[model samples]
Target: MKKQLFISIAAFGILLSTGCTKLNETVLDESSAGGLTDKQAAESMIVPVYATLPNLFTHTNYFALNEISTDEAILPYRGGTDWGDNGIYIAMHTHNYTSTDPNLRNTWNLIFQGISRSLTAITTLPGINDASAKTFLAEARAMRAYYSMLTLDMFGLIFVKEDPTALSEIKRGSEAYDYILNEFLAAEPDLSSDVTHGRMSKQAVWGLLARLYLNAAVYKNLYAGQFTFAGEDMDKVIEYCDKVINSGRYELSPEYFAIFNDNNDTNKEIVFAVDQRADLNGHNRMAYFSLSGDQFPLPEFVGANGTDGPAITPDYYRTWENAYAPEDPKVDPRFYKENLSIYSNANDTCVPAANFYINRGILRGQQYGLIRRNGVFLKCANGNMLVGKLFHDTRNRPTLPVDFTEKVDFSVEGSNYPSGYRVEKYEFSRKSASGRNFGEANIVIVRLADIYLMRAEAKLRKSGDAAGALADVNLVRASRTARTPAPPALSNMDLDLLFRERGFELYWEMLRRSDMIRFGKYEGTWTEKTDANPQKRIFPIPQTAIDAASNLPGYLVQNPGY
Candidate 1:
C-alpha cells in the first residue's frame, strides 16, 4: 500500500506542463542529462499518469455519465433554479445530449489528457538504461491502455500513435478494441505485482484486463444488441479475475463502510484506487456530495454543510426495497443508516449547540438531525439532543421533511430540492469540516468483491453454470471477513437476480454504465430517461474533437447517430 506522502503528484503536473505537446517535442533535457539521475527522470515521467486519475470521477466527469445517466442517480435542477446547467443533466438522463454538452467534452478532454501523458511517458521513459526503466515503460503502456479503453468505451474512436513524430490515427470498433487488449497483454509481464493502489501494478493490470474482456462484446459491436460474450472473452474474464483473487493479496473488508473510510488506503480489498489525502490532491466531494442541505454531518467543522448535489433514483432504491422484507435498510450490511446520532467538529463534545451528524449511506423516511439555533446546538427539555424534520433551504423556512418519497417530477419546473435519496457510499471524513474537498479516502476502482462478481457473471454468461455462478455470489455474501452482521445469503439465483445483485454491490462505483449496456438495459425507461437509441449507448465524439481533427482531413469522424 503506497502512502499518500510517497509521491508528489503536484510536481508531476508542473513537469507535465512542459511535456504536453505533439510527439514531435524534443526530448532534449533527459536524453542527454548531466544533472538529474536516471531514476529521477523516470519518476518524473510517470507522475503525470497518476495526475489524470483523481479528476476522472470528480463532479461532472465520468461518474456523471456512468451514474447520473443510468437509473442509479440523478442531478436534477434543485428548486427549479439551481443545477439547471442549460438542462444538460436532464439531457444526459434523457439521452438527448449533443456533442456540445460541456460534461461530455470535459470527460473527453480529461481522458485524452491521460492518454497524452501516458504517451509522453511511453515515448520518453525508454531513454534511460536501467531495469527499473522497463517497469516504468510497461506501466506507461498500461496506463495508456486504460485511458484508451475509456475513450473506446465511451466514444467508438481512439487515437493510435506509432511513434512520437507520427500523426495519430483514429481507430474505431474492433480495431481499437484489439489495440487496447494488446497494450494490456504487452504490459503484463513487465508490471510489478506490488499493491500500489494509485499506480499501475500487476493486480491492477489483471483487474483492468478482466474489465476490458468483460465488456469486449459491447466494445466489438458498439450499439448492436446481439453482443455475444464470446466463449474466449468470457474465459479471459474468468482467467484475469482468478489472477487477482488467487494472488493472496486482497479480501472483502469486514465492515462494508471500512472500504470507503479515510483509512481505506490500508484496506486489502482495494486492488486499484485513486489515492486522496489531506497532503495530496484529494477531493472531499464524495462524502458530502449527496446529502441534502438540511442533513448536516459535521456541524463542529466550520463550513461543513451539504452541497445537496446528486441523489439516487427512486428506481434504484427500489432494488433494495424489493430484496428485503419490510424494506428496512438497517437490516442490510450494505446500507449504513444513522438515526439519533450527535456530531460535532473537531471532537469538541461541547460542539456548539447548533449542529448534528446524519448517518451515512441511503437516507430515507423522516430524516432526524440537529439544527443550529443562535449558534448553539439545540437540546430537548429532557436533556436529549433535539431532532426534527430536515428542511429544504438554508433559511430553513420552507419546512421540507427529509422523507424521500417516490414519484419525483422530472421536469425542470417540477424538480424539488428534496426529491431523491442521498447516498454516502464513500465514508464521510470526520477529520475536517471542509472534508469534502480535502478527503483522504482512496476512491476504490477495483476490489475483491467486484472480482468475485465478475467471475460469477462470466461463469453464468459463458457456460450456463447457474450453480457455479450462485456459488461465487455466495462467496462474496458469506465472506464478509471485514464486515460484521452480514446480509442474508442469496439462493435460487438467476440472471435477473444476478443483475439486481450487481446493482446492490457496485452501485455508484462507476460500473453501472457498462453493466447496463452489457445487460441490454441501457436503453430501458426509468425516471426522466426514455430514449433507447442504440447510438446513444456510445457517446458522440465531442464536436470540438471532431472539429480539431478536421484540420487533419480524414483523421477523425463522429460515431453513428450523433
Candidate 2:
C-alpha cells in the first residue's frame, strides 16, 4: 500500500535530496494488493503506482529538468550537496548557474529511483483481479510509460528493467524512446477511457502519448539535431487530442485561480493532477516556494514566511510584448496572479495578517526590512502569479516568536517580489506551524490546460494556421485574464508571439527547459544570460550511476562534450 502512494507521499520529500526509499516504501505486499487471490491484486497495486505521480518530477524533477530548461525559474541554492547538483550545467543551459558543485545526484537518483518504483508496480501489478485493481494496473502502466517518456525526454536513456532488484540494462537514446512508446501503445487498450481528473485513465494516457509524439522530432534527434514532426506523427497527436476533446469526459475549468487553488482537484478542467491531501500524503514546498508574506495580501498575507526563490528578469517580464497581445496592464487576471498576486484567499476579504506564516525565509527569497508609502505606488498592491512562489526554508531567516501566532495585517512589498507580485499557488498553512498536515496542495503533472496548449502548438505548427493556433493559445490565455477590465489578446501571430503566449500562460509550471529546446531558445541568451551549449540541453548522466556500472565501455562517454 505504501508503494502505491508514490504521488501522495511527495509531501514528505518536497525538499528531499535523496534517500527517500523507506519514506515511500510500498506497504502493500502480496495480500494487501488483493494478492494472489485473482480478486483485485492488480487494482490494489495500481493505487500505489499513481500515488507516486506528483512526486515524480516535483522538487527534484523540476529543478533537474523543468526549471533548468525554462525561462521563469532557476535553482537558487548553491554549494549544497542536496538536489540539482549540476549547478554549473544549469548555468551552461541558462548560462547562469555558477557553482562548481558536485554533479547533480538528486535528480539522477529521484528519477531513476522513481522509475524503478514504477517498474516494480508494472511488473507486479498484473497479478490482481478486482475492478479497482484492474483500473490501478491500467493507470500504473500508463504512468510507467509517462515516466519512461520523461526519462527519454531529459536524458535520452532509461534503465528498462521493471524488477526492482534487476541489474541495470541501459537502453540508449532513441531506443529508449521506442521502448517507452511501445509500453504506451500496449497500455492504450488497458487504460480506462473514464475521466478521473487527477487519476490516470485512458484519456490521460492518450494526452501523454500525444505529447511524446508532438515532440517526436526532438526525441528522435536525441536533443542533438532539429527534426521535423513526420506527417504521421502529427496525425497521431491530433488523434489523441480528438479522443480527449470528443470524449466529453473532461473540459477546461472556467476560473483561473480555481484551477490551482485548494479546491482545484475537483475542477472539470483537470485531467490529471498530483493529488495532495492536507493530513494524508502531500507535496510540501512546491506550491509554497514561490510566495512570501510581504507580497501575499490581506491579514495573514501581509508578510511571507519563507525566502522567495527566484524572480522574473525585468527583461523576461517584458517578453510579454508579443505584438499580438493587448495592452499590458489590461491583461487577464491570470497575468495578475500568474505574473503577480499577493493575497491568499485567507480572509475572503480581510486578507491575511503577517504573523501566521510557516516562518519567513525558511523558503525566503527577499525579506523586506523596510516599507513606506510612495505616491508612485498604488495604495493597494496586487501579486503576479506568472512568477509563482519561490520560498524554501531559508537559512537566513529565523522562526516566529510566541505571540504573533495568527493574522497580523500590515503592508510591505517583498523586495524579492517580481515587480511587486506574490504567488498563491500553494496555500498558506491554516495554522502557521502545527507540526503536521499543515499545507497540502496538488502538484499538477498533466492537465487539460497543458494538453490544450500542446495541441495548440502542434496545430499551429502542423497546420501553419497562425491565427487558428493563436485562438487555441488565447483560449487558454483568456481564462487567466478575467480580473482585468480590458484583457490581453494575441496582437500579431508569430513564433515570438506564440512563445510569449506560452510564457504568459505556462510560466513556472515546470516546462521551461523543454519548451526552450523545442523552440530553439534554450541555447539563446537572456537575463543573467549564459551562452547555451548544445550538449547541455540534456544533462550528463550522473557520475554515481556511471560508477555503479563499470563494465560498459561507452556507459560514461559523457553527454558528447563534458
lDDT (0 to 1) per candidate: 0.75, 0.52
Compared with the true structure, what per-residue lDDT tens digits does model 2 show for residues 153-259? 76677776656676667776568778878888887786666544656677777888888887787887855656576777877887887777778877665556566
Q: How many residue pairs collide in each prediction?
A: 15, 97
Model 2, stretches more than 4 Å misplaced? 1-44, 75-103, 162-168, 223-225, 293-304, 321-326, 338-424, 429-439, 480-486
TM-score to true structure, per model: 0.88, 0.74
Residue 534 local lDDT, model 1:
86
Kindly provide the TM-score of model 2 when superposed on the true structure, using C-alpha atoms: 0.74
lDDT per residue as tens, model 1, 290-389: 7766665654543555776787887887888878968575577777645243322322223333344456677665565656565554656655455555
Off by over 4 Å in 1: 1-35, 339-357, 373-389, 393-398, 411-414, 431-433, 481-484
Lowest lDDT sum, 10 consecutive residues, model 1, at 19-28
**Which candidate tops lDDT?**
1
